[model samples]
Target: MAELLVAGGGIGGLAVALAAAGRGYRVTVLERRDAFTELGAGIQLAPNAFRALDRLGVGEQVRERAVFIDELRLMDGTTDEVINTMSLGTAYRERFGNPYAVVHRTDLYQPLLDACRRTPGVELCTGAAVTGYEQDADRVTAVLANGERVGGDALVGADGIHSAVRAQMIRDGEPLVSGHTIYRSVIPMDRVPEHLRSNAVTLWAGPGWHFVHYPISGGREFNLAVTKDDGAREAVTGRPTPADHVLAQFPEIGPKAGLLLRLGEQWKSWVLCDRDPVPGWTDGRVVLTGDAAHPMLQYAAQGACMALEGAVHLGSVLDCDAGDLPQRLIDHNYALAPRTARAQQVARAMGREVYHPAGVAAKERNAEIGSLSQAELHGKVAWLHHGTP
Candidate 1:
């Protein structure tokens, strides 16, 4: 079996470790942080992601801590009317084979960690920062920030948007920060008004601004995300404005949205960024996954799901092969590129629709969406909501 090293302990890297360990490969995860903690946010895991977690035997634990939403509700910003809705609750389960769920970022990480701790071939090392790597014909070695070295048969960069290993691969390409910024925060369920806390993902779309909110942590809290177009900020800019400044931008979000922002305990800004699809995700013994490979805006709500799918597919390819290590890695990337590209395109389009809808065009678009037949709505998201193994 191959010895694998995964840099970064985010969802993608941990999934890779789980996939590798299941196949009896020796896997080590090196995380730079001293303790495992996720930033403020919630992620939606569709059926595909649930199937992937099921492969690791942690699906039940995840479900116990997450909120299972049945539908996605699109609303009119001015009228506060439900424009359109998709049945992700029962309909999705019938179409796909699993349920969609929402959870705090930490809830998603904990069960994966527990499973990794129990697996014999899996090891997790914290506070270990990977600085660079050296690859030869037969093996790869990761150099730690403190002058330590770890050797393995191959390396996977699940290190996220600021990947050091991805940097080494491109040598010439860098991520372009789309001139947009997202503000995020979460609040306790008690803080949210009773009318807004339901098993639906509510989205408010308006010109140059949009808001997303959903119940998470088994209905104990609500996750909130706001995105707006920011005119050209200088590269390497300073910190974003405080939560109050963010609240000031959304005076039209109505009572529920306003209440959520007023009650959120912490808030932060993230510069939205993405890159053109790379021709390949592997070179020799190193490969890339997740945001490191294809970062996209949250409008699609598939970031974690796509990463989960990639990990499962990568593991399945490797698990079925006993020889030709490099070719197997190449095949993994080949299978993933098309899928990631399509998802990226959809994400970009969704971002434009939500934040850059032209003039009064947003109203017309919302009307069209509300008038869509079930077949039409399902057709638009079939690729994402019902992915096959």
Candidate 2:
């Protein structure tokens, strides 16, 4: 079995490590943090994502930690009108052959990390920051911050949006701020009012901003994500303001949503960033995955899905041609790049529509989305929610 080195122990890195180890390869993952930690908020595992998890042998565990929803509710924040509703429970199962669920980021991370730790062929080393790498025709040598050098038959850059590997590839580029900032928070399920705690992924769209909320952990709590275009606003001055601060920014939201926002604690702000897709991700035996390869806008919710797909495709390619590892890496990049590029474009377009609609167009768009039949909504996201690729 070829020895592989994976950088960054985030979701993508951990998934790749588990997938590769399950295939009987010797794998070592170097994570910069002191321990395994998951930052960020809720993650929606669409059907395609679930399929990937199933393949990695943690599907049931993921389901147990997530909330299953039947529909996606769309509303107008300004007028408090129901714009559209899409059936997710049956529609997702029929379209993608799996269920749609929302999971806490930590809940998703722990299972994958635990699997990797228990795997026979996997070695995880924390506090080892990768400084650089040197590759000859035969192998790649990763340089650690502590001046230690580790050799591997191949390297997988499963690092995150600010990947060190990606920096080495496209040395001239950086993640471009998408001019949108999201205010995120999570509240315990019991804290939310009974009626507002529907088992649905609810979204309220308005001019220049949108609010989304959904139950996670089997309805144990709600994850709220509110986004707005950062137009002419000044730099964010202080720490994440309370939910009341968010509601005050836009008093136009529905009373229930605004009330919920005011009640949320530990509010935080994240400036969205993305990069244009590149044509290639492989240089000899080293390759990029997830946000490193395609940093996408959050509108499509396919960022994690794309990472999962990349892990599966990369593992399949390597397993298929263990003898020709370099060629296999190239083929793997080719197979994965187009799908990621398409998803990146779609995510950016969705961001434009959802975050910057003009004048009356916002209300019309909201109404149209709200009125969408379950079938139409399913068809619209078939490329993403369905495992067609």
Candidate 3:
């Protein structure tokens, strides 16, 4: 069997390993962290992401832990009026062949990790940071920080946005900062008032900021994320941001939106950053997937979904005969680049047009959203939710 070495034990890397192992390949995953853990609070998995999870053999596990959402409501932050609502219940499932759901990051990550552990041909190694790599005509070897070299038929760089493997292969500069900051928190569902404990994903859009909240962790917790254009350009993580500091950013928000924002405690903030879509992501036997290949803003909430899709595609392409390994990697890049590039572009557009708008522009956005019928709303995202690997 062919050996596949994956750098990074994130959701994307583990999904890739599971897919590869399912296809009869021996897979080894190296994670920089000593233990596999996800830091974020929650994630929204549209039907497209669910399709990828199902193909990786973890769909049922994910579904058991996920909270199936009924609708997505876009509201005017200053007026507390919902501009539009998209149905995500049975109609959505019937149309997309899967359900739209939200999950705690750990709830999703743990199952992938457990599946990896149970798989026969998959190996999970921690504390192995990939520093560099060496590759030739036949095989590639990932160089670890501790000076160990692991050889494999192919090396996959799923090491996230600051990927060491990408640094050696593409030599791209630092990721571009969006001059936007986000404060995130997850609180016990019981802590949220009954009125605020929504079973749906709700987004409040204002002039220069937006707030989103949803039920996660099997309805035990609520995940809140607030994004604004405060021009902070540093990507700080896990720093305790006071609830007051978060509230201060949205002084003019409506009472309903304010109530949700004020409910969050012990918020953590990070500066948003992404890279421009590159022309290619494959170099010989080494290939890039997920954030390493195409990082995007969270406005569209498709970052992790895209990563999951790419993982399945990468594994499927590599499961073929060994003689075409290099070409197959190139094919993987070609297959994924266009869709991810479009997603990146659309995400940026959504930040400007939908998430943060001012005065007349905001009104116009509301009008546009309110005018969309259910079919039109579904058609707008058909390309993304129904994309093929």
TM-score of every prediction relative to native? 0.94, 0.95, 0.98
lDDT by candidate, in order shown: 0.80, 0.81, 0.91
Better of 1 and 3 by TM-score: 3
Ten-residue stretch with the least lDDT total in model 1 = 231-240
Q: How accurate locally is residue 92 in candidate 2, as Cα lDDT from 0 to 100?
A: 63
Give the Cα error of residue 41 in candidate 3, in Å.
0.4
| Candidate 3 off by > 4 Å | none
Tell me the TM-score of model 3.
Answer: 0.98
Candidate topping lDDT: 3
| Candidate 3 clashing pairs, residues 3+ apart or interchain | none
State how far residue 207 of model 3 sits from its true place (Å): 0.6
- Give the per-residue lDDT of model 3 (tens digit) for 1-389: 99999999999999999988988889999999999888889899998999999899899999999999989999999999999999986767788998889999988899899999999899999999999899889999999999999999999999999999999889988888998899999999998988677789999999999999999989999999999988877877678899888898888899998988888998999899999999799999999999999999998889999999998998889778777999999988997898899999999999999999999999999999999999899889888987564
Q: How do the residues 1-389 of candidate 1 rate in per-residue lDDT, one tens digit apiece?
A: 67999999888888989998888789999899997656657898888888888887888999989888888888765457777988875666887788878999899989988888888898899988887789888899998888999999889998887788888886645677777777777778887777656898888776677778898888888888877777545333224468778887777766655665566656777777777777698988888999988877677888888888888887877674434667888989988888888888888888787545756788778877888976788778778877644
Model 2 stretches astray by more than 4 angstroms: 232-239, 320-323
Each candidate's clash count:
1, 4, 0
Give model 2 RMSD, 1 decimal.
2.1
Candidate 2 lDDT over residue span 179-232, tens digit each:
777888888889987877788888877677888888876677789888877652
Candidate 3 all-Cα RMSD:
0.9
